[model samples]
Structures are given as structure tokens and as C-alpha cells.
Target chain A: DAMVIQNPRYQVTQFGKPVTLSCSQTLNHNVMYWYQQKSSQAPKLLFHYYDKDFNNEADTPDNFQSRRPNTSFCFLDIRSPGLGDAAMYLCATSTRESMSTDTQYFGPGTRLTVL
Target chain B: AQSVAQPEDQVNVAEGNPLTVKCTYSVSGNPYLFWYVQYPNRGLQFLLKYITGDNLVKGSYGFEAEFNKSQTSFHLKKPSALVSDSALYFCARGIKAAGNKLTFGGGTRVLVKP
Candidate 1:
């Protein structure tokens, strides 16, 4: 099935260490997004790429960065991992046609644990 | 400020009983609405959406949602609850002015007792 996939479902990293989370999609959607979801809270948008044009959320921290090397692959880079940053990171994809109405498909998510 | 609201933190329902998850949004213009379901340790799965036309929208896994313009609400419904249906549900909205992002509700956990 054409779906989104994330690597290393669970990740463990030390404080201040840099870690990368990967996401790839078979759906070939034009838009890819990264979101941080804390415990018992709604998933917060971090950044997204609309066909190589990166759009970052205003409130997103500097430690968080993302890169879409190609249409099928996107990576989230944590420059400095913090205990508070340990949460499920989700990647989603959608089409560019009508952003307000298009449905986003999501991956299983990568759960990051800070040590 | 634009926001999506899911009033209930959790909803408990007996198996075979009807289930309802309430959601309300405050936004400008006509916004697109969506419902997503998340199982434990999994990403959200799209359930349904409301763009225009039908007020009542049916979706996967026997789920349906009603869009009420006056109330600014889109509530999800299931005629018969199942034990397997227990999960976290989130309501989201996409406003054209907000760019390419969906503002999600706080989420509502549903527990269907068998």
C-alpha cells in the first residue's frame, strides 16, 4: 500500500546530542510535514516542505530543523536534544492542491527518548 | 485566535451503544474540518472530513460526523460502539488564511466497554 513510513520507531539519545528522525512516503504527495506531539497534548506543527520550499512554524524552536532531500524522503534534525523534547515525532504528507481540503496521511511516528 | 476545541477529555460508552465525540471550532471564513483517530503507539489515521455540500459525512471504520454551521461544531458519531473502537480522537480545522496547516483540538479519549 502507498503509505508513509518512519524509521526507528523508538529512539534514545543523550542530552545535547544531535539526533535525526527519518520519514519516507510512497504516496508521492507534494507536501511533507513534521510535528511534535507531547504527552496528553495535541500534535504541534514544527515544519513542512511544499515541494522543496520549507515553511517553519513561528513557534518552532531553533533546535528543531528539517530537510526534504527529495519528494519521497524527509528528515527531522534535533540539533540539541533536551529532556523536554522527548516525544513522538510524526511525519505527514498531503497534496498541494487545495491545502485547506486535502487529507494528510501520517506515518506511525518516531518516539524519541532523551537520556 | 483561531482554534479547534474538543470539549471532552474522555468519553465512556458501553458496547453496542451509540457514541458521540463533540468538537467545536472558532475560525474566520468557511473552514475545512476533519476527524482523526489514533491508536496506542500509532500515528493518527484520517477518519473523515467536511469541505462543503453534505452536512453529514461518513468515513472509514463505521464513523460519521455532522457539520453544523450555526453551532460551529463538527461532532463524530458511531451508531454502535465496539471494543475495538476505543482510541484517541482529534478534531482539526484548516482555514485558508492559515496557510497549509491544520489546527488540531486537544483530543478526546474514547473508552468502549465490552
Candidate 2:
């Protein structure tokens, strides 16, 4: 079935170390988004890619970066992991042309633990 | 800007009883409302959405939501709550013309006791 998939459901990284979380989709949607969800909080949008164009949220930290190397794959790279950065990272996809009723499909999410 | 609000942090309901989760939204243009359910350690699953037309929209898992234009609310409802229905519920809003970015509510955890 067509669905979004994320690698390394749980990840552990040392403080200040670089880590990458991967997301791939079989749905072939035109838009891909990355969100950070802390415990007991709503998922916050970090960045998204409408095709090759990257759109970053205004409040997203500089340490967070993302790349959409191709239509099906997107990667979130943390330049320097911090304790506060430990949270569930979610990846979602949607077909933008269906803008009015577009529904985002999500992956299981990668849980990052910064030590 | 588009935003969604789930007033209750948690809701407790008895099995087989009716349940309602409150949601209010703010949007510049016509609102596209949606409801998603998340189980523990799992991704969010879409339950339903209201794009336009009817005020009542039925969706997966015997769930439904009523859209009130005047109240700026879209509350999730179920006739008979089930124990398996317990999970975190989220309300989200998106602008008609703002691409596909969604603004989600803080989420309300629902507990259905048997």
C-alpha cells in the first residue's frame, strides 16, 4: 500500500553530535513536511518542501535543516543535537494540487533521544 | 493565520455512552477542518474532514463531526463510545488558499472506560 515510512523508529545521539532522520513515501505526493512533536504538545511544523522549494517555519531553529533530494525522499538533519531536541520527529505528505481538501498522511515517526 | 483549539486537555467517557470532543477554529478564509486520531507510539490517522457543503461529515471508525459556521466550531462526535476508541484526538485547520500547511490543536486525550 502507498504510505509514508521513516527510518530508525528510535534514535540515540550524543549532545552536539550530528544526526539525520530519513523519510520516504510511496504515495508520490508533491509536498513533504517535517514536524517536531514533544511529549504532551502539538506537533510543530519545522519545514516542508513543495517539490524542490523548501519552506521553513519562522520559529524553527538554525540547528534544524532539511533536504528533499528527490520526489520520494526527504531528510531532516540536526547540525548539533541538544537535550531539548529529543522528541518525536514526524514526516507527512500531501498532494498540493488538491489544496482545498488535501489530507496529510503521516509516518510512524522517529523518536530521537539526545544524550 | 489559521489556528485550531481543543479546549479540553482530556475527556473521560464511559463505554457505550455518547462522546463529544470540542474544537474551535480561527481562519482568514473559508476553513478546512479535520480530525485525526493517534494511538500510543503511533502516527496520526485521519478520521474525517469538512471542506465544504454539508455541516455533518461522517468518517472512518464510525466517527462524525459537525461543522458550525456561526460558532466557528467543528466538534467530533460518536453515538456509542468504545474502549478501543481511546486515544489522543487532534483538531486541525487549513486555509482554503494557503497550500496544504495545517495548524493543529494541542490535542485532547480521550479515555473510554469499560
Candidate 3:
């Protein structure tokens, strides 16, 4: 039952407050990714970690940051949550071998609500 | 740059009827295509992928996709639709050198009426 898991399925934070969403995996994949998915839109890639190397998307905002402390854990940090930042944040994992074909497995997303 | 296009915003199908979700792509070199399904309040589940070889690829939950090189399209299909099959479907494209970064299309929501 190797799968990706996200903590605090639903999160509520005040505007301008910092919040962190956690993701852990049992799949032992070499890559971990964070995506922001607004209602009725495709999941947009925010950043990802290829092993220990962090890759950020060009359009990703400065308020968004990520950390991968170890293979199994990755965290997304929002330095200053905005009302527009309220969306479902998804974490996904994939092996280097399978990544070429885009076989990423996703965790249940964390829905963030900024008040 | 790799990009995907899902033309339809939503598709409506009757139960037991065949269903098709359209997808097209633009990428450098040979394209790698994938289809994923997402239920309400849940993460996306992989349905199938097309890399090489045969044009037709079968995947989980009786879903299959046909890869057309000439059309630059990979369309997902099912012989018989079920009510439980209703969900949001996404098409994505990946490049071999891009690691795990996938360019996804705006999703198409499928509604199977029972």
C-alpha cells in the first residue's frame, strides 16, 4: 500500500499569515512535486524536487516555497497567504525511470482557505 | 515547450454508451502522453499513457486511449460508460529531458447519466 499522503486535508489561515502543507510518501520515488489547483482548473506546477535538487517554475510567485528534507517528505511553505492563494495544493511523487512517461502518483490534496 | 489542449470543457454521455474525451498536444521530439482522472475532493488517479509502439493503450478502470502521431492527439475512450465513471479527466504531456514536469491541459469534466 505504498502511496502519497498529505496532512490537514483542509486548512484555514488568515491573510498574510504563513502556512505550511506537508506531504510524505511510502513509494520511495526519487521525485516529489507540488502543484496548485484552483477550482475547475488544471493543477499548475509550482515546484518540484528531483532527489535533493529543487526546481521552481518560472511563473511561480515568490510567496511560494518548498523544502524536501528527505526522500519521503516534502513541504510547501506559503510565506504570505493571499485570498487568491486559496486553492487545493496537491503533492505528487514519481520515480526517475517513470517520470519520462509522466506516471506521477498524487496524494489527496490539501484545500487551503485564506480568510 | 510542451503543451496539451483539451478542447471540450465538459462531455455528457448516457450510461452504457461509448464515451470519448479529446486531447491534443504540442511538444519537442516524440511526445509522451498520459490521461488521469480526478474524483471530487480526491487526488488524480492515473488512467493510462502512450509512449511508443502500438497506438492503442489500455489502462485502469476499463479506460483506453488511442495515440495518433499524425493528428498529434491522444483521445481517451470507453466502450461502455458507467455512472461511477463520471469525473474530471485531464491530458498531460511530458518531455524525456524535463524530468517530472508535465504540461497539463485544462481538464474536461465528464458526466455519465444513468
| Candidate maximizing TM-score | 1
- Which candidate number has the best DockQ? 3
Clash number by candidate, in order:
0, 0, 0
TM-score of chain A of each: 0.98, 0.97, 0.97
Q: Indicate the docking level reached by candidate 2.
A: medium
Candidate 1 docking: what grade? medium
Q: TM-score winner between 1 and 2, please give it.
A: 1
- Each prediction's whole-model lDDT (CA): 0.93, 0.92, 0.92
Model 2 error, position A52 (Å): 0.9
Worst 10 residues of 3 chain A by lDDT: A94-103
lDDT tens digits by residue: candidate 2, B81-105: 9999999999998755444778899
Tell me the tens digit of each residue's lDDT in model 1 across B11-112: 999999999999998857666899999999999999999999989999999999999989999999999999999999999988674346888999999999
Q: State, as a TM-score between 0 and 1, how close model 1 is to the true structure.
A: 0.97
DockQ of each: 0.69, 0.68, 0.72
lDDT of 2: 0.92
True lDDT of residue B62, candidate 1: 96
What's each prediction's TM-score?
0.97, 0.96, 0.96
Ranked by TM-score from best down, the candidates are: 1, 3, 2
